[model samples]
Target: MKVTLERNHLLKSLSHVHRVVERRNTYPILANVLFKASDDHVELRATDLDIEVTESVPAMVSTPGATTVPAHTLYEIVRKLSDGAEVRLETDGGENMVLTSGRSRFNLACLNPDSFPDLKSGAFAHEFDIAAASLRELIERTQFAISNEETRYYLNGIYFHAVQNSASGSLFRAVATDGHRMARAEIAAPAGAEGMGGIIVPKKTVGEVQKLLDGVDGDVHVEVSDTKIRVTVGPVVLLSKLIEGTFPDYDRVTPKNNDKQMLVDKAGFAIAVDRVSTIASDRGGKAVKLSASNGLLELSVTNPDHGTASEEVAVDFETDGFEIGFNARYLLDIITQIRTESAVFLFNDANSPTLVKEEGSEANALYVLMPMRV
Candidate 1:
């Protein structure tokens, strides 16, 4: 195989796909990115058996063929070369790939591209397109709530599925929880996104995909099935296996009507909580208390090991007074996800969950945080 590619183009495409490459694989090819030349384009792909990513970049192809070279090695080689440097790749049989740019040259041991595992790109039965802005909002609104505990793997990813409500009719929703708190965000259900099962997209894949889509310029194509899910944005495609388990019934955990409500500026409340939490202990048993009455709300933290801190913020409220304690970190997390300038909070009492909603949107996004006994 012989191909010539511009340094920056190859680097950008490799950067997108390399995140899915398996770093520690006994099978050497698994650690490599497949470079294939076909139909006047060079294709790059990487996978960790569970997830795969593919991208195409422009290149001048002399002999159309394919080879596998260490993904990290190739990425490093291309990155270190001067910008705009032309990269030339050549393989003598399936041995090693010769890489050269200017005075820099390196040889990467190659594995037969034919041995690379065939990963599904999902001819997925169901597909839909959602605006990039909407998809970005959905990911940001709930990603902070996904659990990191592997033993409870089903909770490790943002849950995507279809749902219906009297207020919204039908919807595309994303929900995540880490036991202590939950975030639920929704967008209008798009055409062609029907009859699909829920899936848990793992944490690593989500983080990488978020970066890729963060600055993208167009709509993203979403495809899902029983075992695999794929999202295609522009020239890149990300395919990940669905977590093989059922997510916990999240609806039951959301508070129906918490009886007490308070409306305040999102920024003001979040800043007060953050300042108060500076002295709050982060240990499991520690908490920051919210005391609400009339139109005054006080956020205070008691840290016996350190000192006590408090802040009083005025909020618009008329419900019965209540005091609730919550893990300070979790509270900040839910608050930061709000997109609006104002926020609403609902509480039943010290012993029940507190509900929070961002203000001024018709969206059904809501957050639930269980009170901590302090």
Candidate 2:
């Protein structure tokens, strides 16, 4: 197999696909990327059993063939090569693959392409195209709440589904929770997605999809099935297995009658919480107390081993004063998702979950954070 590719083009394709190759693999072939060259194009594919990524780049093909090579090693070599250098990869039915660029040459061990695992492409039950920006927004707003606990594998990913409401006929919703906090975001459902069922998109897949959407502007093709999901962005394709467990009914956890409203600057509130959290006791708990009255909100944290810290911020509060305690880290995570300058917080009492939203936005995104005893 022989192919000549530009340094930048090869580097970009390698960077996109090689991330799926595990650094340490139980099987040697799993650590390598399968390279297939034919008809003026080179396809790079990598997988770790559950997730697979493939990227195709235009290349000058000399002898059309296929082989596998260590993904990380090849990526590193191409990354360090001179900019604009023409990269040539050649393997003559030998155990070693020769990589040549300018005066630099490296011989890398090659693995049998026949031994590489095939990524199964089954017929998808649902397929649609969504704006990359909208899809990216849904992921960023909810992914932080996905649980990392292995025991509750159901909570390890974002629950994506379609819902119907009086306000919005059809909506695409993404919900995630780690038991302490929950985030839900909704967008207008794309055509052809109304019949789709709920699926748990694993955290790794969400991360890889987010990476593919960065600085990318176009419609992304999405395909979903009972056990797998596939996303296509231009020349790259990402396929991942859906988590098997069922996600809990998240609507039951959201507060319904929280009427007390407090609106504050998102940046200012986040900064105040962060500053006061410094004095929170790591031994006892990292909780910060929020005391809100008419037009002011005070944040304070106390630690037996350390001194107490307090900060006051101006806010728009109408209801009577109330105090609530929450994990400082959770509050920061929720606040970061608010894109607008103003963040709206709804409270029932100090003991119940608080509802948070961005003010003056038609986007139906909400965050629920359970209170902690400070």
Candidate 3:
């Protein structure tokens, strides 16, 4: 097989697909990427048994054939090559594949393409198109809250499903939680995605899909089945297996009647939380106290070994005095997700979960944070 492609094209395609290849594989072929050249294009495919990524790039194919080569090795070589250089790859039915660029040449061991495992995708039960920007926002707003705990496998990923919103009618919602905090984001559901069931997308898959959607405009095609989910963005296709465990009922955790409202500058509140957390004790647990009452908000943290710190910020609070303790890191996480200038916090009491929302926006996103003992 022989093909010639521009250095930039090959490098970009490799970067998109090679991330799926594992560094250490029980099967030798699993560590390599399958390259096939035919019909004026080259296809690159990589998989780690559970997830697969395939990308196609325009190339000049002099000979039509296929082979497998080390994914990282090839990527590094192409990355170091001079810009605008033409890269030539050829293998004449031999164990070694020849790579040639301007003033450079290298031979890499090749594996039989037949040895690569097939990533079978069954019939898609639902297919819809969503704006790339909206999809990316959904992932970014909720992915940070996904749990890293392995014991409760259900909390390790984002849960996606269709729901009815009173203000916006049909909506596609994404929710993630790790017991300490929970994040939820919604976008208008596409026309064809009415009765789709909920699916738990693994954290790794959500990250990869986020990368593909970065800086991308227009619509992305999404296909989902019972066991797998597939996303198509332009010339790239990403497939991932769904988490087998069921996600917990997140609605029950959200506070229904938190009427104590405290509105503060989002940026200022985030800065105050960060500043007080500096004096918090990592060994004793990083905790910060939030005391809010009519137009005043005070943040305080104390560590017996270290020192104590507090900061007062102005807010638009009219409710009676209320104080709450929470993990500093958790408060910062939810604050960062607020895109507006003001962050609105609703509290029932010191121990109840607090509800956060972006002030003055039609965007349907909410965050629930569980308070901790001081």
> How much is 332 displaced in model 1, in angstroms?
0.8
Candidate 2 residues lying further than 4 Å off, grouped into runs, are none
lDDT of 1 by residue, 1-374 (tens): 89899999999999998877766887777998998997778999999888889999999999999999889878887888998999999887869889988888888898889999878564677899988888888889899999989899989888888876678667888898999999998888888764456778887777877988888767899888878888898999888887788999988878886877789888999899989888877673558888877788898888888989999899988864667898888888988887788888888878888899977667468999999987
* Stretches of model 3 off by over 4 angstroms after superposition: none
Model 1 regions more than 4 Å off: 121-123, 284-286, 319-321
Candidate 3: C-alpha RMSD to true structure equals 1.2
lDDT of 2 at 256: 98
Candidates' C-alpha lDDT: 0.85, 0.93, 0.92
Enumerate residue pairs that collide in model 3.
Answer: none
TM-score, candidate 1, is 0.95
Candidate numbers sorted by lDDT from highest down: 2, 3, 1
**lDDT per residue as tens, model 3, 250-330:** 999899999888889999999999999998998757999988766788999999988899999999888757789999998
lDDT, candidate 2, 199-223, per-residue tens: 9999999999999999999799999
Superposition error at 104 for model 1 (Å): 1.5
Q: Which model, 1 or 3, shows the larger TM-score?
A: 3
